[model samples]
Target: MRKEETVDYHIKVVWHAISRMYNQGGAMKGITASSGFVLLNIDQDEGTPATKIAPLLGMESRSLTRMLKTMEETGLIYRERDTEDKRSVRIYLTEAGKKQRDFSRKAVIFFNDKVREAVSPKKLEAFFDVMTTIDNVIEENKNLDQKIQLIENE
Candidate 1:
């Protein structure tokens, strides 16, 4: 029942720590963690559809639209209209974006490497399995809301 014992609390605390670390590192390079993630999600060679980026990051389209606009103004990314479809757009990283994305990628790899150094592969696999199960439960709408609704119904 204690907050420290809750699954979400630990996940959130660790996530916030990671976010702060990423933000600090990214700030020096004139990008935020969010922007770096967007850059990484973009396809390097062919570009990625504008519509697909939001879902990949679990973000709303409106928020991504604003972020994309800022990225565009900063010369990190460019939008291209599809040749056959006027309404469809693709996002491509500029040289600067690619550089930042690489940095982000390296940071993530370094973090993972450190974790692997500290933890056994078996434990890491168990951790990943638990996280995946939690994600699947939430995605399937089998979380707290459903339990609360069921209690109310009864």
Candidate 2:
């Protein structure tokens, strides 16, 4: 199939476009799309656990550690020892972090609102259904590479 016709190509292209848009919007706030995402995932009121943020953002702990350090240095976030679990750390947003998070939220909502206005509700529902199906297919094929390797040995 042509690259333009491939599902993965379209998904990747659209995601990159979205990322670029977010990065542009975040630039004004002195944040990148990634940092904005991290800020939003952190709970401002109660603080989120250090371990929990990585899974929420689908990031590796090492990458998050570096990002968190940068955020701390920038005065966007602070780390506190978990009171109940002394070994664990909790991440809380500073006032600056809250402002950035709000910006990210509004940007996301604006994008969604524009998309919703352009697409019919029925079409939007169909799109969501297709995305869900794609996720399920991926889960079902989790062992596909191993199975393919086994077949290749036969």
- Candidate with the greatest TM-score versus the true structure: 1
**Per-model TM values vs. the true structure:** 0.90, 0.88
Q: List runs of model 2 lying over 4 Å from the truth.
A: 143-154
lDDT of 2: 0.92
Clashing pairs in 1: none
Query: Which residue ranges in model 1 land beyond 4 Å of their true spot?
Result: 142-154
Measured over all alpha carbons after superposition, the RMSD of each candidate to the real structure, in angstroms, is: 2.2, 2.1
Query: What is the C-alpha lDDT profile of model 1 across 69-106, one tens digit per residue?
Result: 99999999999997778899999999998998999999
Please, what is the whole-model Cα lDDT of each candidate in the order they appear? Answer: 0.93, 0.92
Candidate 2 steric clashes: 0
Cα deviation at 151, candidate 1, in Å, is: 6.4
